[model samples]
Target: MATIPAKYFIALVPEGKIQEEATALKEEMKNLFNLKYALKSPAHITIKMPFEWNENKEDKLIYKLQKFLAGIGVFDLKFRDFDRFGRRVIFVDVLPSATLQSLQESLGKFCKLELNLINELSDRAFHPHLTISFKDVKPKNFDLYWKHIQSKHFNADYQVRDVALLKRMEGRWKVIHRFPLTEA
Candidate 1:
């Protein structure tokens, strides 16, 4: 029998205080989303998402990551507030900033040119966000969920020093590599 393929997601994880606030926010989201399972650790702003890859491909992916990250430098990021996306997904919207927009666009291009992962779910044109809660919620519950989430607010900010490669294994996500975005 063929094994179920593992998935990998790359993200820019916030360090220190912001990480803590985001963690707390996850609790709020869990309740609002009426989640069935526990949330994952290392709350972050994703740059790339679930892609099929083998364990042996780590080094090559890292190399590609390094090359793509070259010329790109560290930038600040702020997790402004919580907002639900059509009731199915919950995310913290990031306030627009040029640094953030450039980074997202560049990464989107690199993911296309280097990794060849197609399927653009979001605008690479705008700054991206950190997903706090997601579930396959029933349509009837959508308004109930959004109304609950509407009253809550999340305001956390942090400098984005590094981005990471996270791989899912044995039913959990693990950070495989963290590449720093150096000062220009």
Candidate 2:
């Protein structure tokens, strides 16, 4: 018998008004550009890129995350406008904040030390943004979509109180566990 691998990533999910606006933008993008891939998951700023592990090891991984997050304090996250990774991708830009950067660094270290997961991309540096369209975007339509949204305005501010563990099941990613950051 073959066993399935468990895929997971850590992210800060936007809430309240921010979430609503993000969702609306995603819908518009899907309709206008036929970019349905972006709708697979809720809007979120990724803290750690996706990694695979044995399904049996999930409990241990979550335990380590809970302990690590317990000592952190909540901070603010703000999104000002839209940006892109060249022409292939478009995303909501997250303004740089010291607190958010520190949290990401701390999480990366903890994952390396405790979970034994060395995320090379996150370790080198952090570029925090919420993706609106990716992967399935066609090169032929990239310029058209990019030009339409490049100067569009979007703004939202929300508290970064919890980091969620999203797992891929079937073909879509879903939030399986959420670890709240407490005032420490």
lDDT of each: 0.71, 0.85
What is the C-alpha lDDT profile of model 2 across 110-142, one tens digit per residue? 878888888686555688998889988888889
For each candidate in turn, the TM-score is 0.82, 0.92
Candidate 2's C-alpha lDDT? 0.85
> Per-residue lDDT tens digits of candidate 1, residues 137-166?
566777776676567777766677788888
CA error at residue 49 for candidate 1, angstroms: 2.4
Q: Model 1: C-alpha RMSD to truth?
A: 3.2
lDDT: worst 10-residue window of model 1: 32-41
Candidate 2 segments exceeding 4 Å error: 1-4
Off by over 4 Å in 1: 1-5, 29-33, 36-38, 123-127
